[model samples]
Target: MIEPAARPRATAAWLLLALLAAAAYLLGLGGQHIPKNGDESVYMHIARLTAGTGQWLPLQSEIEGLARNTKPPLLFWQAMVAGSWGEAWSLWRLRLPSYLYTLASALLVGALAARLVARPGANDAPRPPLQVAALAVLVYLAFFSTYRYSRPYLTSAPETFWMFAPFFAIAWSPARVLGSRLGFPLLAGVALGIACLYKSFALVLPVALALGACYQVAGPRGRGLFVLRRAGFWSDVGRVLLAAIVATALFALWFVVDPAPAEVWREFVVGENAGKFNARESYLGKALAGSGSIWGLIPGYAVNAGLLMPVVVGLLFAAWRARSGADASERVLWLWLLVLLLVFMLPSQRSARYLVAAMPALAVLMVLHWPRIARGWFIATLLMALLATLFALNVALGVQALEPSAGGYSAGLWLWLLAMAAACVAGLVKDGWTRPVAALISAAFYVAFAWVTAPLEGPAGRYDDAVIERLRGEAVMVPSNFNGDFERYQFLLPGARIEHYFAAQPVDFDGLPALLAGHRFVIVQRRVGQPPCADERAEACRVVAARWDIRSRQTNAEIRASLLRAPQDFWFAREYLVERLAAAEGRP
Candidate 1:
């Protein structure tokens, strides 16, 4: 048992961990710009519509002919609440809830660690429960996915929290409430229900597996037969059923209450959920064949977890080495990790984010076995840190050689690189406190890396408020053939009315004059090696406003050629603001 005096220190350690998470997730949050992608914009648009419409049932968007019922109403509701709190709607305000969710996830991990470590069967010989818990929090905060997706208005952070909440809840339930009743299991069901409301019914698989694993391990000799023999086992089974029923009922509420159930059924149930799994080209397949393949997930996982993947491997190896002696809690955690991996791997739409549901369990297991794996962990930490420093220096050198004025190659970046190098050296020197020190240093490195290298929308040159201002309150025509660039336009010019042409039909230059009869402005892409005006009919429109150095929407072959031909030149599209001179002049 933990001593009375040690409790305060443990509390302090938890507080410190919370502070580190807050700093990592919340600091410089508003300063960084949103990515130039449709995902972020799409959510933002839905949120804006939610706030404007206040109906909140259908999950609509501002863009015409677009209805988004793919995701549930929880995130959109959170975004609406966030939008209302601040005076003006900003990306930071929209994303504030995600930061809080991320912090809560870290706290939950820490709490779960504390619980497991304090248990009688935990391997606490190598380190104290408090120390292990602290390391777990650090590991979570330093994860590459935590750093990347934690600050965005994405579903990963909340989904990760809700899915893992039931495990801890069920574990701590028997102690908090009376046995053979509907206390903890019911609560676990509610947590699962909330997760379903947040994402989808897919979460049910892992939750069921975790609860089943817990039941199996809770029995004598970790056997399923013994668990089946117990009277309380049936009660536990009832509780799990209760949880699933509750989760299912809550999810069904959407279908019951929504104004357009058919749309939800078609869009969400079929398009998003069913379509994702049935697709022949899985995300994993695309990764392996298109870009890097199966090996890519390694670096992807490492980078997402703050380059502590080697430590994860070491912990796994250590756990395997000592598997014969693992206690109930360790077995449960391993089962949780395995179940998540198995369920996620079966789906075609695999991503690193999909594996985030298992990270908290992985962090706890790693900390539990840290003492046995300290040497390997330390060595891996140093090697990763060294590699990171070398890579940073190489990139800095490359930027200095190619573009001396590049934003990333600055004095501040150099200082951060040196600081990372110093921390790695300190970890190598400090023998007794190496693990904690490495955790602290690695967390700091990721925090610094995030703040220093956070991508800004201004650098992309995709959206210019000034250019957008020119078209404010005016109807703008966009080619339906252009991918999702129009979403960016809608984001920039929220007040401007937008209409799509050639949506169902092919682009006909002869019909340009008739299409521009009523519209004064049309946004079109000017591809490289193509004339500004494609044909004679297009000559009626003259360029009124153009933003150079914007990324081009072209095929891979063209992009590759452009990169090869003009290595130094910015490979961006020149966005043309074409005005129909005839229409503007009211000519016949």
Candidate 2:
């Protein structure tokens, strides 16, 4: 068994690892492309409007000319910061907050792991070396979905951060109750309340807390309360509840006074959440979230984000030991993990990242099993990390073998391997803080690689950089064959009023002539369905598309359309849509 005397050093090592991992991400991965999912456009637009007008716009808008509004305004408020800063939002500015939240999450996860695995209140159970904490964080970052979706611009990024922050609060600082003295369980409530604003899944946290409380109050732990004859137990429960109420009130306040609150409420709360229970087309519905299958979410999460195989394999043997006789805190963490698993099970919508809130829990679980990890297994993991970094670097930098005669392994690969081997030998031999030093070096190397290579990988990031350099106009519209392209565009373009015209939306094409009549430049994707020109200038319209095909040179092509008569057709159509959408909600 690990000695208590070594605890502090171990804990320090993990902390160091977290810092190294975060530093790498900040420097190397900060400005990569964030895909423009459909919702991002809406959030980006709303934020621009909210920031500009300083008013909470209804969470309803015209999308490519269709009058539709769903989803809460919380994420919009996040993006609003980006929009309010200028005519066009800054990519770094808009995304930075999300990144920071993610980093905070990493810190929280490391701390929680230390709390769970370290001897509680021992103050000397050889605090987990910072290397262990760093390893946990690194393993988490390497996990697919959490790393991808944790970028600051995605609504998921904010939601994930807020949701997890409460778990951290519960694990690290349990006494900062917001309402106990004032009126209720305010501190806990506020943390949870903000999470509720971020997304619907946040509600699960309170449920978890309540269940935990119930278990404590009714089960074996209750003996303490009765024996003490001190009402602190009851008082603690009251404080927690009061905190919940305050948080609820704060979140509800956002919905209570707005002129269109009812509409926003119905669409966001009822339609977005409740409707998912019925509407198949809704985001969390069958198509998006895998609604009906018995093993839908778990498998999807595992495959999409690669969580299943690694985590499951790592923890398999420890399963019985973990569940049979673990401590209360360990049991609580297991419950927390279960709650996360169950929460996503029924949502008609399921994405790998939807389970991101589980990262901390998973991190803790892994650390619990670390002592039992065979030496061979540890070395294999290290080899994998090194390989991943090498492959990623090659992909990002277009590095190829120096000698054509050489197989996949080139001089660079051999050199890197040798350097890693030398480091590993040194780490193995060092008497003090060897693991911490090795982990630091490893995390730093990957971070540096991520920073240099991610920038040139996609057009969205490239365009964002280009736009920042050349801010000639108000908005930049990048044509997309698919909706995913926009996240990066939104992340990059900052505050530019974004308008999309897609072949997928024929009306956008039908109305294209009018949409571009006043605009000089239009960003178009390759596969976009071309609209027929109505006037003599039809021949002049240019077309530009990204050439992903090797023979085509993967270029972003643009076409210039000739001037046409100011079209009156689409204005009537748009106004008609606006009226129809307004009518659906009985809007004046």
Candidate 3:
């Protein structure tokens, strides 16, 4: 345990790490290939298309099938405003709002943690809330999900902010917010409505369930049982019902305002939301089986933490151990987490990402029980960070070996990696330093990743201005093996229309030219050292420009090789922009 006299110094160190974690998130904001959800480009597509139309009522997208209006317009509107309707567009600028939202959510998480924790016993000197709050914020940012999902111009950060804002308020002042019949609930509804606009109106069910359950818990306590009249049950019911109505009404505004209400209903409501509860598979079977099973979701909070999963397990046991005399406000948070898990189970389509909005509660609970959690969890996190930093350092050194001509990551990045390794070593050896160092290493690892990938978003990995200029109005056939991935070309090649063909790993090299038969300009991917075109097809197409790329999807063999041998070969690729000289006239 940290001595009382030195606790302030310890808290200061945590506060510094919190600031570092916050700043790290912004360092490589504009990268073409950074850690992010696959749908980031898809969301960017809708936002760009909607901005092109000069209206926000109906969300626009060029994506075919049910993906056109898969989500409401708030996220699109955010991108439009951020990009200045495409006048001053950049990936960094577009992603800035999500970062801000993430920062705000972190602040709220810290605040909730600070509030939920009770004062230390009279025997101990008064401890600063700053210490716990800063750790909470650091832990939240250190989450791999926070890094993966929050940084992209996606729904996760903003939706997490608006959706969790109500709980933050309720936790901050349970007496006032929970007691209010209409005031707080109205605001909560609007907040949730905004969240729904970013995600789906289906979220209202979970949010409402959480709200009502919290209200019930806030009611007069009498022997762990509910007496309707004494518990103010009807008033609490009114609160939940009113909030649900407001949220639903606000979401329905899409239909009221959009030019194509029927399209919105069919595409968004039915295909996007209602499709989750399919009659083809029994709900119980869906819950119990396959990759999307509820079992996967049960441990999501920890899994989302990535390196700190052990700490989450420790936090869970700590919560269980402290359940008997827990604070009511804290119980509200537990109820919120429970409600999310329960409601999401009903949908046949379940994902760990859906549990993200509950992470703030997890952060608070961890902070409240930080001391109670066994030290082994913290040690495990430090060990994982040590291994990851070692791996990244190896990759960095190997990158130099692979491409000596192109300078690898800078000295500062090497030093950063070394620093994380050193800190992990120190934490592993010392009990008192373990927790704070665990957070620093987790956050540091993300920064290291961003620094290493920074060059990919720079001149070295991208096509020169000349290539982007020539391909302005042309149709370029690009390969896409994942959802909305080819949409990345809209930014890469500014006025070009991108067409896609499936090109998964073990790329069909023999069929490369056929893919470019109709299009004058096309992009093809090949592993480094491979020829741009097969010998027989050399005359069919000519390589105009080539740029470095990363093969994000890898086979098991590639993963094994990356882990055991040459990672640079498996991770890096060369993307060629080819012109079909064989085509008679290739405008179409």
Candidate 4:
């Protein structure tokens, strides 16, 4: 018979998950700032232009220049619908869907982790019925990366969802029968297909799942080569392939109804994913040229996941308790996790963000061991969560609060209270270390949601007030300080015409004047690794100042240049002809 504890645990899990989602939604609605990433700006522009024409196209040919068919239409189509509401909508509003996807992604992680812990041989098996579920929620909630990106408007959120959903479905395979097995894998296929539509690396997820299954079923056959001759292998492979085909068909449904369906598909799938992956050189140079291996941005990943060390410790402890009891199926969980981590770390092409795809597995690992950890460890985790909550509060209140009383929210305060509340829950659930840990996790999620919900500085805060003041109502040639800065200027200063140049490549000295024509205001800033033209007699773009440290100097120069151009309205135009040319042809 089902245990009574299961009902309460499940209820708590659902309720907490709902609460977290609500907080994310509220934060998204409140005065949250959109990321000022270059790719975001590019996407926004594409969306705007698509809305205008009722067809996807680059907004300003000279500015955006890329073929509109390059990226798959799913996200662009979403953005187009969003842009139809009007450009007057706030950036945060435009990014609302991404925020929703992020929250959904987080909840899925919680669910997957819980499922893993509920498996028969898991260390939490003999514990109270809801123990594993509560622990899963805690493990998921405490992850910093999950919290950080949970509020951002980016394809990564959707991509993350698609990538992990398949794994979750696959992990739950034993719960169903043979023909029914295809159900989860099919859904997994569709999710992966959508993920592929977002980013090419998405293919890795389904492939990893396949590899994981192979590794698991390969007892005497062998890890790498045994699958080649197995009878069940072809059947399994066929099902997965069918799922992939179905996923492709679902993805094609949108474009199939569009005017240039075939063209769009080819460009999106082949040109964007295949092109980007195969292309050895970037806009700067070879992608591998300047890239050096670092210990793979793990700290950044940790912070993003919201301080996950406790979860790791819990997972280890749980594993230790279940070591002797673990069965073949239980062992598959560890192997799958190992496969996920290996894939994430494989990309000598590393970024903290890349680790997101494997996050669900990490959460599962944490939850699997939640039952056996010591009470002291659970207490330590709660205190640490509270500390993080406090730090977030200070940043939001002390720093972000200084700006215009951002839309009726104080993310920091909310987050702090959340942490404190979790601490209280932990104290109450003092049955064993697991109960306390679960409570602490609940509290941590609340804290993170509160902290993120609070209105904070986005890319817009980086602008110079003086420059904003000076450029009011003036046509200007703006610096490509970052992607969204100029777009922000468009809103801040009505009637300001802008010819913005990104600093991705060296500028051609010839095209400066025509690019700046009919514009009186100018803003210039140094690009990373590119210092100002040292020559005092420089004729094209003059140095705004001698120096002002490093990153700060660029902003200072941009402000100074805007000031210098304020009087004559004849600001110097920096050349970016080369950079423009490179991206135009889809260099990187």
Candidate 5:
């Protein structure tokens, strides 16, 4: 977003750095502590189970109440192909598609942003297309929502790419869709349908709404607010309708292809899609109150930007100030964003994630208004990244100290952290460097997070090879606080019949082993310093192997203690793979 103070080479370097950092951000994506929803493992569980069946129809799931049709089959298929149909199943393999999809979308965003700015309307002064385009890619990748959901075997990346593609095309050249009645509409419909197949059918509404808005204010009618002529308006409406119908028809393929069409209708179309309408007591009341309120959702655009939230605030101000002067193309981007927001506002289950598809448009808008935005926003972003950098280093230190066996942080890893610290400092000081630094800072934090958890993928994070082989074809009870969280064991201890125990339940350290009775081999958790077998005579358990884990969902007190005092005590825990010597084969 910054005009190069000197040479374009520096800008190119920053772009390359941002791209590499983006890749590095997802380095340990499959680990336990990445920022993601519980749905990830659930989706993975379904995909793995479905992959085992070797048939595409009727998406599989072990999660009760939300069987076969919890989500569309496409995401499962994606995970299946990525994981090699359960033969080479690993969290990283399952999540690779998500990373690729996100990267593709970011590339499209950069090219579109450069195109939008290169034209006469968006920029205040002439800037190189390459510079603006590279910065846009960095900005899109820097988004917190993109960082959180764009990887980790989730549908966010594919849905974002497919759903936003049509808009990107329209914004790139309005005449393509608006010029031909059926050509663009049909193609756009196919794209939206695929997106719906990845995510949910409910998304079709927003896609349709955004497409309608884009067409209404595009071409000859773009300069003014309305189409004015009755025939022209009807023509546009018909085109939008055709697109929506096509998208819905593609979604209907699920019902047609699946063996149990009736179940797909009931479980997915009714339960998943229609169930969102089951609102609270009063629609307006709920809209005005609670965490799900319309007010909370209003600033979703900024919220999605995470550390770059301030930059978005500046973008909003800049857009408002230049509202009167903005061109049709710029306004089209605005309409797509606004329409998505308003359409999703109607749903009972409103989340910022619903607006992620429109994020590429947001990235374009950010690039167009970048020069006008305040430098203070960049400073704010650098400060946040600086804080995250410290956390990364501190946690890495803690993790390293805990595991002397896992080769301590490599030189390359240490250098990466050092570079992050340096970038944060430079961004805060020099205004010229701030934009590029802000762009890569989020990815830096992602890398830091990955580094902190990277050891988990090593010996310290996994059981001994011999122990893993011993557990194969045997029952292994693991801790699961959420639906499908135990799916992690599929990769951690493969070929084992894994069952879940409520590890989140309050621990009775004295009787922890007794609590895991009836299973031959059980994975039990205890505080880092707490003894795994405090009551040895109880036949509670015999620790066969152990691994380190940064306990998830720590209390606020624990978090503060982690930073202020001993990191191991409050943040880390030990998971023991113990043998229950005297218990029968009971299940919880």
Candidate 6:
């Protein structure tokens, strides 16, 4: 335990460390290498549309007749506000809010951990609460999912923060509320309401389950019977209900304010919410079918938690050992984890990102129970770390050997692996400090790993300013049959008017010539061994431009041919041809 006088200094040290961690996370955040994923493109499109139209209510999308109210308007509003920062919208500007949200969430994790550690009846032999809290923040930022999805223009980071914030507020409150102040409950309600506005009303499930578990363990109980006869218990229940009502009211404000209330109801409530659950062809349904069972989430959860899995397993074992003597906080933590897992499992569309809300509780529980974990568990965790470090080193060296040019990039990874291996060995050799040492090392390795791999987004490609400049005022046509590639092109070609034709349909091929006559440029896909143009009718479409290959290695004809021969074995290189149709046809 840290003395009260020393606590301030310890906290300051931890804050400095946390700030450093934040900087690592934010390194190259706005780099051009960070390509926009499909989700980011959709959100960016909607945000741009909102910014252009100035429609605060009944959120709209770039796609005509499509409403963007499937999720709440908060993220779009945030993106719109971020986009307004400069004259031109950029990826960094759009993703700024998510970065801030992620930082705030990390800080909140530390605060929550500190609060849980400071509670009465916490483990006597535990490390200082500040140390534990700092470790929790480190563990969270080190998570692979946190590195991947947290900084993107996504709802996971903000949603996780909002969901956990209310629990922290209520759980950290004084043991008893004697007056009618309703402070904690009101704070919880407001947080929950904002979360709902950020994403969906489904957030109510996890919050309710967590609060109920808190009540079960903390509320007064009679001998051999669970009773809620006390005034405080009833007051707590009423406050929770009030919170729910407040959230509902906030959620309903969209319908009342939107000029097209019917559109909001039909699109959001019926189409987005109910439709997702009912339609077997929806994304959720397809995921459930593809996964084979709900248990598919187990592996995903492990991967998302990253290096913390060993600690999680150890914590579980400790909880099982102390099940009979578990305190209110322990019960709440366990219930929170179980409830989050179960609720997410119920959804057809399950993702590791969805489980992020449970990470803070898991971090706190791991810290609270670290002192009780067996030596064997720590040894096993160390062994796992060692194996992981060795594997990373092998892969990095192998890649360097295969491609001499990649040696520069792989050197950093090799160094990180070496450092991780040393840390693991030190932890194994040390006594009474194995867990803390291992945790700190693991955190450092993950941070380094995220930093080294941040440049990997290069392969995903970005908007080519040269391409856009060349075809500034021209209309471009592309095949509508392909997947999300068109959407990406649409986003990149902001100034050019892009139209699509059903090239896959034989009946539409007859009209291809007429379509080409009207458009100056036509973007078409060309597979290896096939003619550059789709058919002889497209002979007038002479290739004038090609898609940019953003990968590290320059692709050649041999590689393209091989990928085309085994399309199922690999994602074939997509070479788009930008043809000047009118010029080829010798038209003025």
Best by lDDT: 3
Error of 2 at 285 (Å): 12
Per-residue alpha-carbon lDDT of model 5 for 1-588, expressed as tens digits? 434576478667767775785667567776666778788889988888888889886778877665668899999998889888988888778877888999899899888987888887556787788778888888888898988888777888999999888888888887665777789889989999999899888888888887777766675444344456634677787888998999999988888898999998888888887887765468788788998888889999999998898899989988899889887678778988998899888878779987888888899899999988888988988888878777777777777777586437778778888899899899888978887778778877777677767777678888878987988899987887777878888888887899876655322234454556666787877876664656667556678898887677677887888887757676777888877755433433
Clashing pairs in 5: none
Mind giving the per-residue lDDT tens digits that candidate 2 earns over 434-508?
433333444545443544334233442234344444434455444544433344455544545555544552234
In Å, residue 499's CA in model 5 sits off its true spot by: 1.4
Lowest summed lDDT window (length 10), candidate 6: 566-575
* Pick by lDDT: 1 or 2, better one: 1
Q: Which ten residues in a row have the lowest lDDT in candidate 4?
A: 544-553
Better-scoring candidate (TM-score), 1 or 3: 3
RMSD of each: 6.2, 11.4, 2.6, 10.2, 3.2, 6.3
In the range 175-208, model 3's lDDT, one tens digit per residue, is 8778776789899999999899889999999999
- Per-model TM against the reference: 0.76, 0.67, 0.94, 0.65, 0.93, 0.77
Off by over 4 Å in 4: 1-25, 28-38, 56-70, 83-88, 106-135, 175-186, 201-226, 229-231, 248-304, 313-336, 344-348, 374-479, 489-588
lDDT of 1 by residue, 1-588 (tens): 447778678657755865765686665565433322336656766767667776777777645544587578887888888878323677668788888888888888877787777776566452465666666787787776776776688777788888877665644442333243566667777777787877887687777866766765653323555557755676666666777888878888888888989998888878778865655665656645643344444444444466677777777678888888776556666777777766665555556666777777777777777777857666677778777676546534533333322334457777877877887877777676567655666666655545443422234333456757767888998765443335445544556787766432222223456666778877665433343445646567776665433343445774566434542233433456677876656743
Backbone clashes counted, model 1 = 12
Question: What does the lDDT read for residue 298 in candidate 5?
Answer: 92
Q: What's the CA error at residue 78 for candidate 2, in Å?
A: 3.1
TM-score of 1: 0.76
Task: Mark the regions of model 6 whose C-alpha exceeds 4 Å error after superposition.
Answer: 1-17, 31-38, 64-67, 119-121, 124-126, 177-181, 220-233, 279-292, 297-303, 374-414, 417-465, 476-577, 581-588
Using TM-score as the measure, the top candidate is 3
Ranking by TM-score: 3, 5, 6, 1, 2, 4
